[model samples]
Target: MRAASVLEADEGRLPVVASEPQSASGLATRLELLRNTLRPTPHVPLAMEGMNLFAKLEYVNPVGSIKDRAAYWILKRAAERGEIRDETTVIESSSGNFAAALAAFTRLVGLRFIPVIDPNISGAYESFLRRICPTVVKVEKRDDTGGFLKTRLQMVKHLCATTPNAYWTNQYGNLDAVEAHYELTAAEICADFESLDSVFIGVSTAGTIAGVSRRLKERYPKVRIIAVDTEGSVIFGGTPRKRHIPGVGSSIVPQLLSHAKIDDVVSIHESDTVEACRALLRTHGLFVGGSSGTAFAAIKRYASRMAVSNRPTVLFLCADRGTAYLDTVFDPAWATRLE
Candidate 1:
């Protein structure tokens, strides 16, 4: 059955897919179970004076990151559209969270996944992907901006052209990535909070912020959509430099970002990102990823400028777990170098 036939789209809400239990054996049954097992992550309140702050604990998702939502939705939609067959191989270029997500989901649905990764990938993520995937492609060359994203994309294209029945997920340009957040992640936030003054989102491929900002603006017209980017990222037109953090910045601006309704852009330094990560662990006991720390630092800076009487109710996404950063952000020596 075609996805269009099985899923009904609503004007202002998520598309409803068929939820009936499948009696068929093998892949079909597993897909149904996977869909059924997917649940919304929680939003926990953070103690702060004047303004009500809450962090959406997206790290609790099956693959331990927000990318799981996008990975599942993209593959599911592709299968419905007849793009994924039993012999098809799914390919994507990612350094960390997204790569791990696609690996887990594709394996679950009986599809072969090959991640074109770079040397900058964290040890934890590299170990996980190598264990599950038969072949992991590594690109050693860097692009003009000294990042491997462009080089990785070139490898992805080459692999797709040479490999039979290869389907590239194309997370950077894929509308499915944006829709996943709009329909699932942002929808959850809107349902939880009737009113929000602003939302701080960390930018990478810009999928999460683009989708969440658009949806939140539709629900709360006046809510400020803040796009938090790293200093070296060119996403918001900043000069490109070497960025140490994996998921917080991008050398190339994502196409999905054009669809967002951004009110302001805040550029954060790597130093601040490290400090914020430690601060969250020390103060709130929330051990989140580098991007989450960047968002938190941006929120604190943004809030400092606001009048005390009008402190806004703030919401930020904790994109992934910090355990992957044990060798970097959570390391005192590593963090000290950034200082």
Candidate 2:
């Protein structure tokens, strides 16, 4: 069977481009198109001392998260490799954004998608998945690591083994996930800002940090790559506790993470995430997710420690929008429960 040509797809098709080009002039203001359209997310500047703080609002992607890039890159590569045809089913484990992204993109290419999620999955995200995805596997149990992430992966393994013509993106270890951010997200940041001194990114599957950090290091060797993780996440040599935030932490260490590329590590608490989220909304009018709050907290911590002369242009990667976290991060009552 001849594989689908990426560029010459039918009208109202999916995966038009593997990734959006690194040019602001290429962005379209129109909506009412396919949900899988990959465009340049905005970079909103913020007020801070010493350093110039800029927030990369990745929530504006077609699926309203940065994972749109990663999911598209993986699927595009799968198509290029002849791994996905008209009838292939793609299965993967995710917390939220990645699942929603894959669901949107898979529908574009006429493929089936199943996302194995956990109990901590955001209410908004779950509803989004239900609307777009045909089947969503909810993993209620936790693994020996005391987190549902491993359990979710286990379920994915079983499904892939039993289902014929099933393909697991295995995003936790997928290098393509890293490549997506490197070629697109990082390139956009560099293009938008000619001189950047540091970048703070949240780590979960570690794809974003791994790719972006490597790219920045190659170009600006002195640029600080700070890794922000929640307290419960084991990614940054922390004890595996329970993390409330979905996008910024991990129970299991991701294969894509390169510790050598990171210059600093900041572990944020759930309360800090909440406080930062509220602050962003009140002060900057940026309604972002818990992980974005985590990144904001990390930005303050990094800024406070640096001397005035040492301060530089700092960028924070906001993982997703507050809409997906409305039930918890934005709700006063629900947020109190976590406290």
Candidate 3:
């Protein structure tokens, strides 16, 4: 272990896949569960009565979220680059899940972590991060610019400037996050579903749309990739998604999104997302985080549009627990925003 540390010291940053799990077997189980849940099925019958739909159950992942894959990739890549070390302090600005995932990944690497949080983040998620990581910084939403990455980017800018020996796993711009999905998510889906028709994904940093879409398209040349965004999202709406689902959709067109192969963009209303979230909890008992709801609402719309009995359709579910949105989508007072 000391020799490996010395090798990393000389290497600058480890190449990729550097962080090792404390229990390889446990990580193996987590990976298998992730694959089983996220892995696309060949032709599962549509759960909805009339529509032909098969949703990839990402909400079934252990972390109760889909961003865990990105979290795993980003942290692992940084270690490969030797960007993160035992004495290194990691920092990231997040609304919730990303921060939580970062804390978990850092804990695995035995690194000091400092999560820069926004006021919009859920208290449950914030408290959980505090317990997992050694340091946490709360940045008020005083200058909160709803979705243009204003609040988060600003907080990260501050941390990077002041903190020493700190590494920012800049997920927003990192290609590794997308590659993680390309190598894992996309390939697994294609291997199972040979005749995939269309893929539906919610856009945020647009990595999910970009990576998985590109991979699926490469495999299923005739496949249609529909990128979904909230009505206020900047991807196609050309404005910030000012709503509470801060993690997905943005004011700026994410660089990761490849506009050409992107076939089309679907904009779902905030109200629909709330409804879908409630439905997931009631029917499937999947208490997902907010981003998954956004994707779910979009795919449900797509299913209705096809209105077919056997059209192949796939949707990405971003997470599993509403624990992150207890005060927002789950609370009656706050949910009234949808009403």
Compute each candidate's TM-score over C-alphas. 0.90, 0.87, 0.81
lDDT for 28 in candidate 2 is 18
Best by TM-score: 1
lDDT of 3 by residue, 162-199 (tens): 88888888777788878877876677677777577767
Model 2: per-residue Cα lDDT over 1-339, one tens digit each: 234344433433333332222111111111113323677778988988787889999988877898888988887766666666555689999988899888877765556789999988887778777766667899898787678998898899999999888999989888888888888888888788878888889888999998899889987878888899998789878888866778988998889886238988999888889989999999999999988999998888767666558668888988888887777888888778763
Cα-based lDDT for every prediction? 0.86, 0.80, 0.66
Better of 1 and 2 by TM-score: 1
Regarding lDDT, does 2 or 3 come out ahead?
2
Which model, 1 or 3, shows the larger lDDT?
A: 1
Error of 2 at 262 (Å): 0.8
Model 3 lDDT-worst window of ten: 1-10
lDDT of 1: 0.86
Off by over 4 Å in 1: 1-32
Which candidate do you rate higher for lDDT, 1 or 2? 1
For candidate 2, give the lDDT of residue 100: 87
